[model samples]
Target: MVAPPPIIVLAFFCGTSIARSASPGPARPAKPAPIAADARHKQLTFRNRPRVVRSGRMRRMNMSTSQPGTEIGYTWPIRVYYEDTDAGGIVFYANYLKFFERARTEWLRACGVDQHRLAEENDAIFIVRSTAVDYRAPARLDDIVKIISRIERLGRASVDFVQEAWREGTLLATGSVRIGCVDRATLRPAAIPPSVLAALRHGPGTSESAD
Candidate 1:
């Protein structure tokens, strides 16, 4: 073969080297955009959201002999509505107090103690004196939770109760509440009426711990 001209060969070599140098190296991946702090917090909240079970799959918690020395009284089943939950669809911690209140009210009604009548006839109304609650698991929206209320201590002017919120076999929250009788007009502490106290003592499914 005939040799190429030196100048042409030199020019071709230079052009090839220039082209190789100008060409891009392996493409680098694009950098992802930074996530907003609030958005990252929301993502983590969603990722760590409590496990929710469908209503159809829910099973009642057994009130077996596991709880010894404690008598289980009335149970009020409450359906969790949208208003009761927070943004994450979990029941708000404060709402459990409302659940306990409802269960206690129902227990009173079952025991033939009507608050309205008691207040009108006896000039006395029950008021919550104090509450102590501990949260365990969480109840989700659309869940049917059972509030179990039992009388822990019964006194002349006040009563103490132990309440629990349960979903299936899972315990969601527990509370201890003390309710005191107060005069309707003065709001001062008053004694629970003899008839009302008697009803509470002998009411169906009612069992008070000895003082």
Candidate 2:
């Protein structure tokens, strides 16, 4: 029998995470894209880009241009639609998870940790270990939220990421996630690849130690 797929949870947010310098590592600004005037146009509807989940994950192809394994982080811009809110038009409590997750995956992709590649070539997978969250305010439908992903720690077998969600320059929520690399079959922790670790250590983040 096939083993059960590991549980994967998304983390949200972008701001002053881990109190690190914003020098070196992934260099591009870790901020959200400015909303276009036409984002609300009918052409920008879900019909143009259907929301679908693949393998228990959101399918976001090339959401960012940064190469994988060494980005300051990835930025995901999401428009709040009617379906994302309550009768009163405020966004529900949980959709924030969806927003930050897309950003994290893009961050991973920017760092070159393709989920497929890690599984095939290295027999490794990143599993979310824990999440610490704080919800500050309610986001309204149609508001564009930006999720930022940046590293807090690179350890022997795990990496910690601090993410945040913002609406129009205001901090809305924050998340601290610990991700562990594990063996595909044994379900045990495994050391990250030398190349991957090296990239992350040298990649965009406020790394004060030797890089």
Candidate 3:
């Protein structure tokens, strides 16, 4: 073949370089690594553990106590796990707060209240304003504890609760929690919706307790 002029070859090379430069390459995002099988199994196990369980075995029993006018309003059962214990092996004092919180949440659910719906539909949410807990004894791992809760006082925007932790008729702890209603967006105090207030007053202690 006859050789082209050096200027012609140079022009062709320059045009190819310009074309390559102007047409950008496609971008490929890096893919996330897949989770390991063991990790996947652990995650599934955690998800399978339910937040609450109400069974037919949980029957309402009118409890008589030493305290004046003390009556059980709601009861929730909890099993102490190793994670709930402290270095000394007994249930951690602070973990009682978690127990009390769970009991109150379940109590409200029994009262026909859904906290998520309250926040989304009514713009209202419940917040713990104050809490006082007294420890009488220690709870150990694998022990099934019952949290007995009752309304000590009810107000337009807040509620006072009396909660106790018991195991086989032994009192482990007692807590007084005050919950206040607030506007979810503004975080300012707000009145409890009338329907919710009515439910709180009438829903619990009116029917057989879920076993």
Give the top-scoring candidate (TM-score).
Answer: 1
Distance from true position, residue 84, model 2, in Å? 2.6
lDDT of 2: 0.69
All candidates in order of TM-score, best leading: 1, 3, 2
Q: What would the per-residue lDDT of candidate 2 be over residues 138-209, giving only the tens digit for each residue?
A: 789778887767676678898777776777657677777778899998979999888778767766542343
Q: Pick the candidate with the highest lDDT.
A: 3
Worst lDDT 10-window in candidate 3: 59-68
**Model 3 Cα lDDT, one tens digit per residue, 6-103:** 99999999999999999979988999899999999999999999797555853223333324234456878999999999999999999999999999
Give the per-residue lDDT of model 1 (tens digit) for 1-211. 9899999999999999999999999999999999999999999999999997656642232223214323366688999999999998899999999999988888899998889999889999999987878898999889999888876677899877778888877778888788899999999999999998888777644454524
Candidate 3's TM-score reads 0.64
The reply for model 1, stretches above 4 Å from the true place, is: 1-71
lDDT, model 1, position 72? 67
Per-candidate TM vs. native?
A: 0.65, 0.60, 0.64
lDDT of each: 0.82, 0.69, 0.83
| Candidate number that wins on lDDT, 1 or 2 | 1
Cα RMSD to the true fold for all candidates = 14.5, 34.2, 17.6
